[model samples]
Target: MTGFLAAVLAATVGAQAPGDGADQRRRLVEQKIRLVDILINSPAARGAAEGHEADARALIEQGHQAVDDARKALADGRFDEAAKLADDALRSVSSAARRMSSGEGALSESAQRKNLQDLGDQVGMYRSSIEELAKDPQKGTGAKALLRRVDGLTAESKQLAEAGRLGEAGKKMAEAYKTAVEELSRLRAGQEVLLSLKFDTPADEYAYEKKRFASNEIMVDMMIAEGRAAGDKRRLVDGFVEEGRRLGTQAEEQAKTGQHAEAVKLMEQASAQLVRALQSMGVPVF
Candidate 1:
């Protein structure tokens, strides 16, 4: 009886170890899901989806659904199921990434030029929007500084494009676009200019909040990938990302409980945390 009891105690101790197999497996699966999420939401994947690439869209959707199911399985203590789903999600997203890469590689020089032109046009539109906001007395005072930054970025992007550095030009334009959007959002907060959309319902507002949160998530991934969040900054950025994710989860919970207003507010806060994280990494998001 003594020996049997000792064996049982040993087994219990093993099960409760800091590096227990089950806990390790759960962590690994969670990491994979995060990686899959980043890949699916990457610029390449997004470009393909925007271009109406059916395969890319379908694969991205499948990966997202798998990730959702994996999270549910994890919550229910179905570790094996969660692991399988996470693996499946990673595979789907990887395939989509490959497809997007191939499509981009197939683009002709002229096509690339056209893409750059489109980005420039987008920057122009953002500049116009900011200029219009500058005409508003209530918002104009704060818009002046942001407008100057956007103008500088826009000019740099144009120079990059003219120099045949299309890729760099695209990045510059994206930065300018992000700055413009963030400035507009800041200036128009608490007004009908919520991202330039007047929500007809709380649901619409919630949807917009979710979109913004997802965009911020992508920016976080980009910063990490670009190695901007390294050394001591990595830990700080990670803290902000974790906080943002926590708030985003809370926002979803609130939305599910029909507290749409609270949900939108929480989500906005979540996105703000992510923006702060990006800034901490020296990203020129604004």
Candidate 2:
């Protein structure tokens, strides 16, 4: 059964189990333990850890042990003890996960607002970086996929905050930020290889230029797309993106004319222009 159904079943059984059979109570407790286990081991939970700090790991481990003890109690025909242990274990797991999710601690309203604003700024930076990274031949699709997940999380964060679920919203925002950081790390690693390419031979130089040209073409397209998304209010960003595209075109033309070194320089200029555009929007691309 789904976790939701399992939760409902546990609640229903708990309410009526005074008159119901001991076996039923045991099953309900087991169901609850199972649900908690699933939640504690989910990707969202792991991401909430930031790096699985010792305290967080300890709480989660304690919950697991409690659940195990609960199971043993149930087997020994101690229904009340089993149920209580299961419930307590579930709460422990949930509290730990919630604590980790918030990234720091529970935020007051003003703090939440400030933190949200900070996270939003980080998200904007990641969004800009993703636009450039998604043009890479090797890591483009992966970066795009990660950006989709980050977008979903950021949307959820906004929805939660709107509904006055400030604590929950903070957690969601933290998770989104963590995900974006991971994506940025990956994107940087991928690009570092290309950026480090040495033109030791004429063939190697030609290959580097060709690959760089293709990558810059995609980057130009992404920069344009970002500009359009920002609309006319961001005319300055649009100008930067336009200039970047122009430089990309010039780079390609220079490459065709066997001016590979100049072509590389133009590509660097194009990338800088795009980065400047993002910085103009309060996103630090560097």
Candidate 3:
């Protein structure tokens, strides 16, 4: 890859579309290309492609040409065409990569073991984060669902490893880690919203509540959706949900009777119950 070609490639990969249907296809193809690039650029793969496997070398050249053509098509405002060319590149590169080595990335057994260990550590970190969130009582159904998935994946990975299928096991563990990281990010976002509700004065409390009313409503709705989505992975949060609704209603009643301070306290209590429900699902609220 020359400097000019590398610059063009970077620009092509970084481009974002408004709402192109081909965007996903392009992204998937790009991932495949990178994987293939790592394999074929290695000494082992390079030797295999250049020596005793003329077909692999040809495929590598074809893949490079296809990528270049795809970049040109995108520059010319032809996303669909570019996407098809990218797919062609991916296919050629993948064929070459396989011919170069039986394993993905031509990973040796030691490298595979190290990769699996790293993935396990990543999953463990996510589990710790989830457990921390679980200490909260008002958020976590969505995260709990994800935790269940991680558990299943972890078990499956262990079974695969026991059966001597290290490659497949490593892939499953890597996927589990990725899923856990994504769930952790979602829980973190929810935590941020809840933490913003604190106030030091009654006036400040009332003012902040008014300002954040819409956000509070959205967060509540989000919790309900997460709870519903938890399905069989659901936690026991119905009582908390009911308590939140009751407190919110009472808060409204108090406000109607000119009990401003009491109304604010009741409203805060209502929010706390809702937050607790979210925490029960492993979302950290503080």
Compute the lDDT for candidate 2. 0.61
Per-residue lDDT of candidate 2, residues 1-286 (tens digit):
1234234334533342353687787767766665565555433344334344556566667778888998898889888888888777776666665565445433346645655665666566567778778887988888889889999999999999999987678668766865675557656763452223345865456445443333323333233334432545355765675687678778878878888778777877876776666556544334
What would you estimate as the lDDT of candidate 1? 0.69
Segments of candidate 2 deviating more than 4 angstroms: 1-17, 47-50, 105-286
In candidate 3, which residue ranges exceed 4 Å CA deviation? 1-95, 100-106, 192-286
Top-scoring candidate (lDDT): 1
- lDDT against the true structure, each candidate: 0.69, 0.61, 0.58
- Residues 121-190 of candidate 3 have per-residue lDDT tens digits of 5577567777667666665676677778888999999899889787789768866765665566777774
lDDT of 1 by residue, 58-137 (tens): 88889899999999998898888887888777667666655554453323445445555655555565677678788888
Looking at candidate 2, the ten consecutive residues that score lowest on lDDT are 1-10
For candidate 2, list the clashing residue pairs, or say none. Answer: none
Higher-scoring candidate on lDDT, 2 or 3:
2
Candidate 1 vs 2: which has more lDDT:
1
The TM-score-based order of candidates, best leading, equals 1, 3, 2
Backbone clash pairs for candidate 1 read none
Order of the predicted models by lDDT, top scorer first: 1, 2, 3
